[model samples]
Target: MSHKNKKISSTPKHTIIKALEKAGGRPKAVTEAADTGSDSEDNSSPENLLTPKDVIAIVTKTIQSELRSIVSELRSEISELGSRTDVVENQLDVVSKHQQTTDTEIADLRAEFSTFKDQLEDLENRNRRNNIWIKNVPESISAEALPDYLEGLFLQMLPDLSKESLNLDRAHRALRPKPNPDQPPRDIIIRFHFFKTKERIMASARNAQSISYSGSHLQLYQDLAQSTLKKRRDLINVTKVLRNHSIKYKWGFPFQLIVSKDGRSHSVRTPEQGLDLLRRLHLIQDSDPSTSASPSQQKTSAPTPSWQKM
Candidate 1:
């Protein structure tokens, strides 16, 4: 048929349009049918028209498109969540490291503070025990002169301490004893006191009878003097014996001695004796006296002295 004179196929248009209206008013089938079919053609046949399956397929496709869009959005949200989790993990790591560092710093500071506190305590202990505060003494004074001088000096200088008599002993009980076949001598030690003079004097006198002096005259001043020369010699001899026996003895710092029965019997070893004893003990070698080398002997018999080496 001539295109100008062709009749319009209103039947196919009507059928497709009716079918589209039943399927939620979709215009796709109507437009496609109108564009492809001629007015003279039998496009109205049911086989050529839109079917139930085609309508269902179109609906499914539309749903799939919407679902795909929703899936993309969900995927984006999941990716964002993952990123957020990573950030949280990083933050947690930073916090954990910071806590560890802070804890270490706290421990270091605590240790430093403990060290400072220990230093302070040591200073306080030293201040309490330091004997240098007693003043106006001669440099030339010997250890033997110290007890009497300091005792009188204390009475005169620090009278507020108490109006007490000072007692001095040249020989104390702690000294090493000398050994002699004729006389079994006792050890010598020196003692000094500020307040307990009578008790010390009595104790010294009582102990004097038991001790052997260098001479009988040395025993005459037993109450005033500490150990006699005989007793001191015996002490040195005993010290040698102890060395021979492979025993170690060390002189400790002079300490205050308080009698439990009476405070008046309290005494102290003069620092001079303490110093001398310490020096002497220091000179005592740890070597086996029976076998080991002696510095004195080595010095006398040096193959070559350091002076000769120079």
Candidate 2:
């Protein structure tokens, strides 16, 4: 066990272990096995000494063996991972196609629903065609007398029209909730028996400028379905622009506004189209705040003489 007799290897095994440790990727088993080899050298006879080349070759052989084992295990795992990736890619492709199909179906359903809604709204408007909305009518009369009261009021506007011609099919306040006594009287909705009579009444009311009942200023409006009202409200700015330019425009059937300019008729169907028409006419500036605003966002314009929310 003399230190002089301990020189079995020229290259110290401890230096090799340190180099492996500094490299930092070798497994702990590599260091442990090197330490065991170093310990065994202490017991070996000097006659059985290893040269520096022999020591280096042993370390290199062990490192290469460990590396080959690691490479083999990694290749197996990488092959399994590649198989899993292929499965996942196939599933994603299937899911992407399914999503596209769902999107197309949803779009079709939405279009169908929109068409149905427009038809329903048109039906509602047609049902209300013969109705006249009378606002600020005094609440003093009984429900049974409401029709008679409305008939008398219309007769004053149309003196030539007989009382029987202005006969109302139905008359009632557009009542909601408990009546607020202090608020201006609830509006009266009167349904004329004949469409021609309703038209005559409306024209006469318009000519009179304003109807007065016992000095209470009465307002008249043609009853419109909520959807039709909304459509008109959306195009309120377009009409405002038209009036500004002395352009003649009238509301067309269903949901269109026909403009007469330069002896040609331009029809607008939607608010978007209304906006485009305004843009083409240079009626509205691109930077105008109303251009970017939605129909509801812009201040709601009322019918001339401000008959709304009836």
Q: How high is the CA lDDT of each candidate model?
A: 0.44, 0.73
> lDDT tens digits, residues 1-310, model 1?
2233645455544644555556544444555555655556344455455666776676566567556855776777788888888888788777777776787798799899966754664454343321112212233344576565445444433344444444443423323444444553443333444325533443354455443222222232222112222323334533454455554543222222222222233232333232234345453434434323234323342242222110
- Model 2: lDDT of residue 248: 84
Query: TM-scores of all models?
Result: 0.31, 0.72
Per-prediction CA RMSD (Å) = 24.8, 12.4
Candidate 2 all-Cα RMSD: 12.4
Which 10 successive residues of model 1 have the least lDDT summed? 301-310
List, in order, the clash count of every candidate structure.
16, 0
